[model samples]
Target: MKAVVVNEGGALSIQNIEMPKITSPDQILVKVAYCGLCGSDIPRIFHHGAHFYPITLGHEFSGTVVDTGHGVTEFDNGDLICCVPLLPCFKCDECQKHYYSLCKNYTFVGSRIAGGFAEYIVLDKKNAFKLPKGISPLEGAFFEPMTVGMHALLLADGCEGKNVVIVGGGTIGLLAMQCAKAMGAKSVAVIDINQQRLDLAKKLGADAVYHSQKLSSEAIHQALSSSRFDQVVLETAGSPVTVNLSIEIAGPRAKIALVGTLHHDITLPEKTFGLILRKELQILGSWMNYSAPWPGKEWQLVSQYFIDGKIKLDELIAGMGDFDSFIKQVTALNGRPMNGKILLNCM
Candidate 1:
């Protein structure tokens, strides 16, 4: 098996490694075909180490089952599948209450353990979800990201006929923009510092797009004819600027969902901090997708949206490359932002 491993000092290498195998009767071995480069993978590779060094790093993926353990009845040797990356201890308090994302005892694929960066990875049947008929390996690989966008919307609650603003045009941001529209937002706007990404957001269904370099938060009011969102989604959490910006743009009593990962502390300026109290805003923090309903019900809805042509990724797939080339793509992309998804052709 070949995998891209993170060794000491966060260095990455595409090396041939031992093949992962099923240790329990409920496990299944998937021959990874395609794996998408998630935003989270960049930091783990180049900065803070998640688990021990020498671990694989990829979670957004889909593959075919090459082998199944004796107890795996729902999946066969040839089944195409996507998986939930979180490996939760089912006996934990959170897991028992159907809150797997909040489970205190958990190991995440691509972080705490070997992930889809390898040729083959083993998973329990509990984490695997069969892809729908005709779902391509590339599309199946994106199921995780789609679920992420869905969960963010779920956290924000209603979107029907209300103005919404997404404060980042990355994968999660773009997906949230489309999901907001699909769920019936009267109009949606996407804000990002990158012009190319904001342009892609417009193409994807955002009614308005703002490049932070060209448009100030107040400038958005003019773009949308003095409109303010009933809800605001802050998806660019890594930046303190965007976190404060989310607070600046939210409407009175509007809810804000913090879906982005904020690696650093966010210190709100006096006026910005005052917005929450002045507007009576509701700030909701959301984490990973769930599996209480069995590998997550949001996965099912996202798959169906793809099937019905309401959602598509043809424009978002920037390129696909082999293992070594895949490493370069992600390495370069971390510094230079692009409009859509990039994948490693693990096969």
Candidate 2:
């Protein structure tokens, strides 16, 4: 089997490796199809960010099942499925409470163990989700990211009939915008410094798009014809500026879900910090998408909405090709901004 392996920090190569086999009764072997490149993959590839060297790095992927272990009754050979990357320790207190994301011990596929950047991989039956009928492998690869936005929405108690503001126009931010609309938000507004992302957001159903570089937070709020978003505000950019803006634009008693992974320590301004107290805001910190019943409703809703044609995945794909093309694309992204998801056809 051919796999892309990062032998050490800042080093990557495509090497023929032994194929993973089903070692447990509750496992399945999947022939890799498409794997989506993530923002986190950038640092793991270019910097010393990976948990270990000589590891295959890809998690958002979909494929066809070639074999299923005897204990796997829900799935069988020829099933099209997407990988749920989070491997939670089922014995932990958090896992017992159905808070899989908050499990004290967790092993992520791409980060902690062998991942899907290869011709084939083995997965635990519980971590493999069958794709709905008519869902392509490429579309199935998007399930992970879609669930990310949905998870935040779920944490905020959903977006139906509410004015929703998503502060970021990146992949996750854009997906969050579409998720809000699909969930019956009265209006969806997106804020971003990138014009291309903002334009794509509009095309994907954002009622209003604001360029954060050109407009002040107050100006953006007024442009939306609202003093502040009283319903929901999702901060998905993970930037300090966007984080502060999320705080400033949230109305009283609003549900603010912090969905992005912040890389730096954020020192909120006195006034910005005061808003949390003054507005009596409900700050919801959402982690990876997982809840009761394992892998939860986020993944289920993403599959349903995608199959129903309510969610868009094609427009969100900025690039797609094989491992060689993926390498070139990664090399070329030298401080360049990525507008959408980049996919690698592993098979």
Best by lDDT: 2
Q: Give the distance in Å from residue 257's predicted Cα in candidate 1 to where it truly belongs.
A: 0.4
Q: Tell me each candidate's TM-score.
A: 0.93, 0.96
Tens-place lDDT digits, model 2, residues 1-347 = 98888766566787888889999999999999999888888778777779988789999999999998888899978999999999898998889989899987988888888888899999888778899888889888988888988999998889898889999988998888888898889999888898988889899999888898898877875676563555799999888888899888778788889988887899999999999999898999999899777789998888778877887878888888888887677667753447788888976
Q: How many pairs collide in each candidate, listed in order?
A: 0, 0
Candidate 2: 10-residue stretch with minimal lDDT: 221-230
- How large is the C-alpha RMSD of every model relative to the true structure? 2.0, 1.5
After TM-score superposition, what is the CA distance of residue 127 in candidate 2 from its true location, in Å? 1.4
Distance (Å) between predicted and true CA of 137, model 1? 1.1
- Pairing residues by index, what is the TM-score of model 1? 0.93
Runs in model 2 lying further than 4 Å from the true structure = 225-229, 335-337
Please write out the lDDT profile of model 1 over residues 89-190, one tens digit for every residue.
Answer: 889888988788898998887877778988899988876889889788888898898888777677676577778888888887877677777778888888
Quick one: RMSD of model 1?
2.0
Model 2 lDDT, full chain set: 0.86
